[model samples]
Target: MSNIIETKVCSEIGDIEGVILHTPGSEVENMTPGNAERALYSDILNLSVAEQEYKQLKQVLNKITKTFEVKDLLTEILEINEVKESLVNNICKSENVKPIKSSLLSLESGELARQLIEGVPLNKTTLTGFLSDERNALRPLHNFFFTRDASMSVYDHVLIGKMANKVRERESMVMEAIFNHSSKIKSKTLNPSSSKHHKDEITIEGGDVLVAREDILVIGTGLRTTTQGIDFIIKKIKKNKGKHSIVVQQLPSKPESFIHLDMVFTLLDRDKCMVYDPIIMQPNKYQTILISIDNGKVKKIEKQSNLVDCLRDLGMPLEPVYCGGKKDIWIQEREQWHSGANFFAVGPGKVIGYARNVYTLEEMNSNGFEIIDAQSVVDGKIQLSDYEKYVIAINGSELARGGGGARCMTMPIRRKKVDW
Candidate 1:
């Protein structure tokens, strides 16, 4: 039998070979307007509509490459008694629900996996449980569908997320468990929790880190990721002897839409990138800095003009496609808030994003990208291979309200090398 999982992601625009996805479950419906903000959601999503839109992306990916579902992977890992006990213990400890450890241990792998993600209902038999205001022993992972945040695959290793929010920390724990213990995967996970360098102030998420090339990384620091987190990544890169570069873009702390780098900047192709000009290109108080590592030691750290200019100076010049079009900043800000800038590359020049951003799609069409509806591709009405570069537009009116796009919902593990 062949190994199903081999981690290798050197570039954002490589030909994707294997990726992980988590179809939104009842966990999404498990939220209420009262606590949605605490869950990092501005608004509760219509799970039915979101699932329909997600299916198109899922079907297209399934047809193009190998795809794994989180629930399935978790189920497989739980079959091993030792792994099951260990994961349950870690979760119980992290959430301060040690009393539920024995209860969770008794569940079979399948049910346990479901409860872990969807949430374990509180047992009202006990006096404390009955009197408690909490509705669950384990709160639902409301943001798990945006799988990109919990764990990141970077050059043969997985960097488990150190979530900025306590509510989402379990997301990282579950992802780390899946990658570390799943028989289907074949790579080691590097968790900040295990590092002596780990500190409560350090925070990193997949959305803020992008592998521009094998030796170059683009990271964002703001509400979701901290400067300390970038320092941790630099230390990790120093362990390997090579010339490496990390471009750090400081983001605004307000407007939750600017939560991560991917929210405003994402690679669309080897020579093309999607960007929100206000943050990535235009002059602003936020600074863009570059750190260079040579032979396992930092050689220099200096400020750069902007993200686009910095990349150009680094030898990979990308044609900027403004999100929500360049005609007006008001339109750009509006669509940017709705996740118009987020795009996920399936191949060198092929990508996927929300179709609701009409201005952005028009810009893509004007710039040599053929627009193809995701539903048509899923229904066999069109063939993706016919176009050399095209954008698979998925319906996301409801999903975008959840604060992410295709890139946020999927985590790529393996990709064919990009020929630049």
Candidate 2:
């Protein structure tokens, strides 16, 4: 067994110690055009191409810090007979596939892990099964590669995401099981379902939550995350005795690109942030609210002029870098649609993003960010430590179509404390 990795993430740009990643697999290709919408995808992905693109991301991270694959972690915990039976039973009951419980339990740990993720083929022996159009008894988790959505590390605890869509709920279940039962991980899980304040309407995803500082959080609420979900987090903070602030940004319900805050806004450095102008800077009807908590009680809640200004008042002032160049709105919209603003910070002033956003890359360059190709770093042609501030650009021609960027693909498990 590997050494236990405790969950500790207090800031977005802290030096990463360990992170969780899921490489694109058969599950991503399992979707067809017929069920693409149901799987939360606008289009189907080419597994081969996606795999090639994902390799750049995986390799780059592997070189920088310890990385754990979801399948490997899940498989390790499944080797424990009790954990396996319990997880299988919970999944079967949740998905209403109890009939397959015994069958699932019979498989070896490795095979069982694969089947759990790749999906279980349906048996046509029954009349209903033969007549059904469904291809699998339990549907494949197409969005599993976006590992940031299911669960997130908050300080010393893991917050199990309550997925907005029913189809993605199993992803959360699998993640919760891994965190709760894995002997190789040390952390308590905070599940909304188990909370006394839990409600059916509460839904939160990892992509919507960003740890700005040890005492501050930035959360987005829209299609994927609800207001009630933010309230749940507020309640959790109320239990802790300290000053805490949550910056809530209301998001657009349409144009799927705005599904999460990270898609339109992400921290680039201690004093810099990437943003899509239309939604974040040139704001419209969307509102930014600041909620402050002190000594286990609600101190104040009020509307803010903008996110940047709000954070500035709270002491963390940041300069905004437009997603595309400042010249054209058309270019900004185009690149932002493909996740131009989504950059994952490995450390302060050090990040990763898509190289396809030429305009966005140009903007970053103008703002003193040295752009480097991901392959160069992976192949040892270039050393990342040589640059104090650089954005490692990965080829995202195919991966971006899945509706996320570098931040959407990573879930930080442990990070070194920032000397602020």
Candidate 3:
């Protein structure tokens, strides 16, 4: 029950103590063919299959560290009388269904928790409501189960996202309230909408922000996070007055797979990085921009060949492991779309990723990370702690369809500082 808080995420390769996660709920079924793509999903998922895949991740995590479910945390926070009333009211008002807040408040905790994620059905008692095809008053949180995107824990402070869509805004609001009010955790939070220092133009998502090192951050700017969002991060760095470096990578505009930084770039180990060959490693039109801040001053802003090159200049040269294992470019493109490059570091040398990405895993094996089945780790047949470097490869066929990988499905709250 440590309440330690952090505002800066210094490194990605550290021991994770606790992480926040949301297991898929009934809200996933509420979505239909009508708004699936708009919700950022290609098609409606079979909740059963998705849940099974999520369980593998959940089970594996349970073996290594303390895991807190988002619903449980939300339910606990709602028990506080002041927080309960204020949160429900604020949520209702924000979602444009203020009339229902009173009704929501009277419900018991179990029901309320279900409704929050599964959604409150669009009351169709009136003629206007009956004619309207809208499915929910407070629409189902189709993306809540993918907890990694809404908000992120960077160092001691939580970075509350400015969701690209209004439908997901409540997720950020809820996460912020949790970090601020929860007695279980101690953390300061940075938010675009609530921060006085940040202009209203700023918009950032946890998916686009990656803590590459204690002094380095790799960010993606395209659809989800805008230039304004990057500037907002710079504002935080400016105020901190430390030697901080930010590398901004421009991603593709279409084919949503390239939406977040983790999609194309992620830390595998101290000296290795998983990368999409075309966008990150090979030469293309994309630009890698570097911004350096020293002692509250805009020290340097320059263009580099790529992220690896920029990092090399800064003394952190990472060996780029191609997603498709240096084979044909077509395979690289196909695998990258399914999140081959997204690997989550459970600790300094312990990582997790999809075993389906054979080439990607092969590359990792070539780089000296022993491959181990996630089930072995969970069932205690194999000990992850026994190895200095290993990857808990999990079955991710169904999970990858949700447009994420191990890194995209997690939100780490506490990680030990890396030696680097």
Tens-place lDDT per residue, model 2, 137-228, is 98888999999999999887899999999899989988998998877778889988875665788999999999999999999999999999
lDDT by candidate, in order shown: 0.92, 0.92, 0.84
Report the C-alpha lDDT of model 1 over 1-420, residue by residue, as the tens digit: 686678889999999999999999899998888889888899989999989988878998987889999999999999998889999999999899998899899999999999999999999999989999778889999999899999999988999999999999988988988888888888878888766765888899999999999889999999999998999999999988879999999999889999999999999988899999899989999999999999999999999999999999999999999999999999999999999999999998899999999999999999899999998888899988899999999999988999999899999999888888
List candidate 1 segments past 4 Å from native: 1-3
TM-score of each: 0.98, 0.98, 0.96
Off by over 4 Å in 2: none
| Least accurate 10 contiguous residues by lDDT in model 3 | 1-10
The stretch of ten residues in a row with the least summed lDDT in candidate 1 is 192-201
Show the colliding residue pairs in model 3.
5-156, 6-156, 6-157, 7-156, 7-157, 8-155, 9-155, 10-213, 10-214
lDDT digits (tens) for residues 1-420 of candidate 3: 435433335678788887888888787877778888767789777889889888989999998877888888788788888888888887888888998898899987767877887789878998988999887888888888778777887656688898888888888877887888877777888877866754566778878888888778889999889888888888877877579999999999878899898999988778888888888877888899999999878798998999998998989989888897897888888888888988888887689999888888888899888999988887899977689889899988778888888888888888878876
